[model samples]
Target: MKYVRKLPATDRQLSNQLIENGWKKIKEPRNFSLAVLFSLPFSYLLGSIILWLAYLLKPTLFEFLISDVLSISFSIDFKMLLYILFVFVYMLIHELIHAVFIPNFTKSKKIFFGLNGLFGFVFTTEPIKKERFLVISIMPFFLLSLVPVFLLNLLGFLNWYTLGLCLINAVGSCVDFLNMFLIAFQVKSGHTIINNGFETYYYPMQNIT
Candidate 1:
């Protein structure tokens, strides 16, 4: 719930404590670029699916995009505004969504968020259960990406502007979605995740108890 100029470095003390308590570190890609590169396939696949489903839900969106987006008649300034706003707003919301889902986020006051270049990140040393951590990871996509598309479609207002935002959010969430899958597959049901800077480690809850 606190904003830091920079995310706290991996808490060696916490890491040692967790290890002493029998926590096992989760192996993650060594760097951000590598992680993003590893997740790009998932990103592309998810992006394609979202675009396809949106097309099915409202075909005219695709029609407008193809016919107008490429045409000189489309207003570049307006589209640019929406793009910029979506990036700015979505960046904050995306990190906030992660922060909100962490158990007793405000009470803990350990959750820290900040921007790294163009990307926003949230991290905490709090040990969150596997299921809970997964929720924190993926909530942003559900709230900001798919929900917007459906809500717009429901209101009969689906258009290229909103559709593009949804797609951008979905693509931007590639790393999170991949992390969800990675943790689910690797970490056991009873495990909990502890963050160390951008790194993550997990261990069985019983070990701490």
Candidate 2:
């Protein structure tokens, strides 16, 4: 029971869709810009918090890792071009993470990978459990960002390659974080969440009428 709440739609359009599917939309749809901007501060805070926890868990190891990341010194000849390319590639990886989790969580082959409004996403209309949904949402940050950084430290390789990847992926994950927040705050355990690849809907087990 990590989170429990009624489901919500982002707007009237999604509201109608959810209603058509026999699910209740309990909240308004969030604007694209607002959703992206709202996650910036929280992402930084969460990044800091994770660092602090890492330090507390292993002070010496954390210090070494920090030093390694900080010691990475190099200049890119085509920084802007590289940044742009990396973003597209990393975003693909991010969406792929979501897509990969679909089969595990849903019995449907209706998964989709595409852009919606101002963002790119992997969407599905399949019903998924709360815990599994969270895992699907958070997997990219863990595999693409966290795991790479951890491995960099463990392998005694200190460079900007993995560090940059982590940072880029972290920033790119703002939307996922927002969705995770909404789901965690609004949805209860044991309930199924349905997504039409854009908005998510939920119905209470005891009150589906």
Candidate 1: tens digits of C-alpha lDDT, residues 43-112: 9977897798788898876675667457546466876877887778878888898888887788877778
TM-score of candidate 2 to 2 decimals:
0.69
**TM-score of each model, paired residue for residue:** 0.87, 0.69
Deviation in angstroms for 67 in model 1?
Answer: 6.9
Query: Which residue pairs in candidate 2 collide?
Result: 4-187, 4-188, 5-186, 10-29, 11-29
* Candidate 1, position 190, lDDT: 72
Q: In lDDT terms, how accurate is model 1?
A: 0.80
lDDT of 1 at 160: 73
- Which numbered prediction scores highest in lDDT against the true structure? 1
lDDT of 2 at 168: 69
Model 1 earns a TM-score of 0.87
Residue ranges of candidate 2 with Cα displaced over 4 Å: 1-17, 20-22, 26-29, 49-84, 104-109, 115-119, 205-209
Clashing pairs in 1: none
